[model samples]
Structures are given as C-alpha cells and as structure tokens.
Target: MEGADWLRTRLTSLHCATCGRSYRDGQIRVRAQRDGLSFVDFVCRACGREANAIVTVVGRGRAARLEVGELAESPPGARSPSLGPADVLAMRRFLRRFNGDFRSLFGADGRAGGRLGA
Candidate 1:
C-alpha cells in the first residue's frame, strides 16, 4: 500500500481524545506531503472536533518507517470555528424545509449523488 494509505489505517485505529470515538477512514484527510513529512487532519464526526497532526514516513516498501508527532489538540471544552447565532438560524431554516427524502432533496437525477448541499 502507499505510505499515506498505511498512515491512514494507523490513524483510523485511534480514537479522538476529546470525544473518545474511533475515527472513520473518510474523516482522516491528508492535507499535504513532501519528502518524509505529511500533514494530516483528523475530524471527529460525532463531536465535530478537528485535530491536526504531522506524520513522518521514511524510506519505502517494506522497510518504510513511520512516525507521528506535533499533534495540535484543541483546548479542553473548545471547538474550532465556533458557530454563531446566524449559523444556527440558517440551519434551522434548512432543516425546516428539509423532508426525510434525501434522494429528492439531493436530486435523484444523480447530479448531486445524494450528498447534502451538492
């Protein structure tokens, strides 16, 4: 497997420090990589908390060595990109207009592929 894929597997096995929830593969995003260093973001779906980390992978193939460091943890009871009253109101309006039918909401013509806000 590629170095990033291997690193993601390792991260997926770990739980979020704030929420204690196992991270899904989709929640682990590799933002950038160069040489032996990689920047990764781990976003917890349950609590909407994000943690930034740096991973180092040296060598290649089976002999590759992996190390992780410089993890930026959020302060206790802190949430990044805090939401405002306007955001809550906007969400309330959307939810009020939203029905349970996601297929129709996202356009069953396959343009949106069932993703919200597509």
Candidate 2:
C-alpha cells in the first residue's frame, strides 16, 4: 500500500465473505497492487472467513495517475483516463454493490437479474 493511498480513499466499504460484516480500512490488508489493480485480503471479525479483492481502477484522475502519484507517465494516448470525480464516485458505488458474479454483472444489461444473484 506504499503507493495506494488514493485507492484507499475510493474503497469506502468492504463486506465480509463469511458473516456479511462490513469491513473497515484497519481490517484490510494489502497483499499486492499495480497501477490500476490491487490484490487485497481482509479477515472478517464476525466469522473469520477472509475476504479478497482484485481491485480494478477504471474511473478517472488518480486511477490513471502513476503508482507513485504522478511521478511519471507513458504519454497521453497510452492511457485512457475517464471523465472526472463523478465517474470515480459511480465506480465506487458499483463496487459497493458487487455480488461477485460476472455473468449477472455484464452479460445482461450489467445488472443482477434475479433474487440472490449478482
């Protein structure tokens, strides 16, 4: 998490996979991360099942900023940054509602189509 403070700001909520308890920053442990993605693990204080995430940044601004906080870049077109803070906020909202399914999330109108589905 040396260079992932900006990412920390965006991930405002995390849910436990074991007992469905909401997670806090102090409970999260960063396993690894790159420019636009991160692999993290957190233990559920309620039931002890570890929760993991491969956090992806597709929003805007710092999501496109270099890992070291604007220290360098690969030229303009090389990176495709989104519009603005609104985009980032939208993505955060999406992640907060993530149900851990790709088909339900992207296969049909990008939504959960049924009860107990993502």
Candidate 3:
C-alpha cells in the first residue's frame, strides 16, 4: 500500500482529543501538505470541541514529531516548545505500537520500519 493509505488507516482510529471518542478505523480525514506533514482532526463528541493534530516525519533519522491541538503552540508566556519528555515518551509509545501503520504511510523508501523502540 502507499504511504497515504497507510497513514489514513492509522489516523482514523485515533481517539478524539476533546471527548475521548474513538473514531472508526479508516474513517478519519487526513490531509498531506507539500512539506510532508500530515494533519488530522477529530471533534470531541461531548463538548463539540475540535482537536487538530499534526505529524511531521523528519529526515532519515527515523524521527517523527507529533503535536496535538494548540498545545503545540507557544503561548504568550511560554518560552519554548510546549512538549515535555513525558509527552514525547507517550508519542513514542504510540508510534511504536502503530509502527506498521506508519511504515505503510511513509513507505519503505522513507525509513526503516519497525517498532518505535526496536
């Protein structure tokens, strides 16, 4: 399968950040930008809030960055990127668990596909 197809399958199964609602697999919308970034959105079922998620695959170092909603933005008082080690760890875990999906999304030519920590 192509990268976009793989990414779409994985992203659509993610839970909505606002309401913790889990979307059906392959049902979520994914848009890829020219810069190689993927945007995923999910609306909270409880509060009707929308959460925007961004995923960027960096160079061949097998590094992937993820940001959720406005939390990724540096607010007026924030001095740096809002992500913490714990958050990074969580993202890593998620990626590791879903490495298959990512590999399909990015393709074998993109990077070595394996579990996140493997």
Candidate 4:
C-alpha cells in the first residue's frame, strides 16, 4: 500500500490542533509524500479550518514504527516536484556529505530542524 493508505489503515482517529475538531480516517488527505511518510492536510469538517498531519512509518513491513504528529500549519507549498524514491536517496547522499554545520542545515530560525513551518 502507499504511504497515505498505510497510515489511514493504521490510524483510528485524529483531531485538528487548531480547532479541536475530530476526524475519522476518511477525512484526512495526502498533501505530500516522502520516504515512508505522508503529509496530510485538509479543512476540518467541523470547524472549517486547515489541519495538517505528518504520518510516518519507519523501518519496513510489520516492524515499522508509525508516528503521527499534528502541525500548526499546512506544509510548505511544493518547493520542487513531488518526492520520490530517488529524492530520498539524494537526501541521504546530502546528509552523508553534511559537515555538521547546524546553521546551514537548519537555517537561521532553526525551523528546518523539525516541523516548525508546518
């Protein structure tokens, strides 16, 4: 199954961080995908506000770790193309070449270190 579909199957329910509106599995929608993660964003059916979800499955198959985090805002609009396997490999390559420059990796706000913008 695709990342989003897998996450949907795994999740029982979710709620909007901004509005406290509850969401069943079918209410969420994928806005982005990278690696074993899916970024889902939608207008809350209850409060009519935007909500974001970062659903990730680490490892593979049955041993994977499924994580879901609420985002204050939707993810950044597509900066480039949709993520793919090749993009993940390229990211791994980039990180491998990283010289541990914290500022360069995370930018001035250190937002890139986590889900700050989204």
Candidate 5:
C-alpha cells in the first residue's frame, strides 16, 4: 500500500496532543511523496491545530509495511515544569562559595557538601 494510505489508517486511531480528539481520514493531507516515503499534515477539526508527520513504507507487495518516522511537536502544556524563582535563588546561594570541586561538594564521607541537609 502507499505511505499516505498507511499513515491515514494509523493516525485515525490516534488522538491529537492538544485537544485529545481522534484524527479522521479527511483531516489528513499528503504534502509530498517520493519513493516509499511521504510527508503528511494533519489538521485537527476540534482544535483547528495542524501537525506534521513523516511516514515510510518498507519492503514490497505483501511484505510492505508502514512506519512512522516522527510526529509533530507535543503540546507545550505537557512539558516538564520549569524551575521556579525559588529554585534559582537556592542555586545562587549554593554557588556563592562553591569552589567548583564536585568531589568536595559531594563530600568524601557520603555527606552532601555546601551545607545541603543530608
């Protein structure tokens, strides 16, 4: 089968990262195709956001199979939380007199140096 056909079939069962809505066949559009590879775009009808994917077809005839190379960027809200102001302040305080010696900072006696409470 073609790369686009395989991708549409696979993507239809997956949900969008932003809106959590399953992708439909109509929502997928093939942007480019060459050899056994295709670049496709998915526009979510629910959130009206767009995502891109790279798909590849390996082998031939009955042995042909589809593989997803990469998907679009994940939703920003799903990322790990960033360090807060308090964390920055604590790091600054610890670095004030740090001699850049990791071994001494970590302590030779299994104790964290820099006055880090055990």
Candidate 6:
C-alpha cells in the first residue's frame, strides 16, 4: 500500500504521557515528512500539552510501530511496532479466534510455515 494509507492504517490513538489521557487518530495531526514514515504531532485536549511522534514502516506484514517522544528522532531501521490499546484488543480477538492454529494465525505461506518445512 501507499505510504499515507499504510501510516493511517497502522497508527491508532496515543495516550498523554503526563495526564494519561488518550487521543484518537483523527484528533491528532500526522504528516509524512520522510520516505515511508510519518511525523505525528499530538495535542492533548485536556492539558494542552503537545507530543512529537514518529511512525515507521518495519516488516513485510501490515504492521507499523508508533513511537512517541518529546522530540523527533531518526527512525530505527527495524523494530516491533508499538501497539495502542485498540491494537491490543484486536490481537486478543485474533488469538481467541485462531487458537492453537499457528498456521492460520500467521498465514500458511508465512515464514513460520516455511521454516517448519510444512
């Protein structure tokens, strides 16, 4: 998928570091300043504090990591994408539905299948 869509699909809301309040995807403004990454700016609605975030593309799957920091930093080459509350919930649901079926969970053509000589 294209950079903008990829970013939008992977990014969820981030919580306020100071107040522990959460902000939605639409409430925050994100800009793709780099190649396939995004520079996210989050403004806390309650306390009016702003946070700088970076979203980077990692592996082949539809996963991306959202890193929130006080200032923008160079993207780390490859790291597990950060999970928001929504992502965690979705993962729980996936595990529930695909219980014990590793192939179904990771895909039959996934690396795990290939590695196991399946």
Listed per model in order, the count of residue pairs whose N, CA or C atoms clash below 3 Å is 0, 0, 1, 0, 0, 1
- Say which prediction, candidate 4 or candidate 6, comes out ahead on TM-score: 4
- Please give the range of 10 consecutive residues that has the lowest summed lDDT in model 2: 65-74
Candidate 5 lDDT at 66 equals 71
Give per-residue CA lDDT, model 2, range 1-118, as digits (tens). 2346655544436565446677666666665777666765565567656545667656576445322221121233432355899998998998899878776555565555544343
Candidate 4 local lDDT, 30-61, one digit each (tens): 76788767877655667656656688777787
Give lDDT: candidate 3, residue 107: 57
lDDT of 2 at 58: 63
Error of 2 at 34 (Å): 1.7
The full ranking of all candidates by lDDT, starting with the best, is 1, 5, 4, 6, 2, 3
> Which candidate number maximizes lDDT?
1
* Candidates' C-alpha lDDT: 0.78, 0.57, 0.53, 0.68, 0.74, 0.59
Pull out the clashing pairs in model 4.
none
CA shift at 5, candidate 3, in angstroms? 2.4
What would the per-residue lDDT of candidate 3 be over residues 53-114, giving only the tens digit for each residue? Answer: 67654543334433333413222442234798999999899777674576665555555444
Candidate 6 TM-score to native: 0.44
- Once superposed on the true structure, which residue ranges of model 3 sit more than 4 Å away at CA? 44-48, 58-118
CA RMSD of each candidate after superposition: 11.8, 18.9, 18.9, 12.1, 10.3, 16.3
Each model's TM-score?
0.54, 0.43, 0.37, 0.48, 0.52, 0.44
| Per-residue C-alpha lDDT of model 5 across residues 1-118, encoded as one tens digit per residue | 4656666776687677789998899988777888777887777889877777887878777787677666695353543467999999999998897778766666666478534534
Runs with alpha carbons beyond 4 Å of true place in candidate 6 = 1-10, 61-118
lDDT of 1 by residue, 1-118 (tens): 2566778877787678887999988999887888778888888899978788888886788887677775687454554467999999999998998778878667787577566555
Candidate 2 versus truth, CA RMSD in Å, comes to 18.9
lDDT of 5 at 72: 91
- In candidate 3 the C-alpha lDDT for residue 40 amounts to 59
- Model 3 poorest ten-residue lDDT run: 71-80
lDDT-superior candidate, 3 or 6: 6
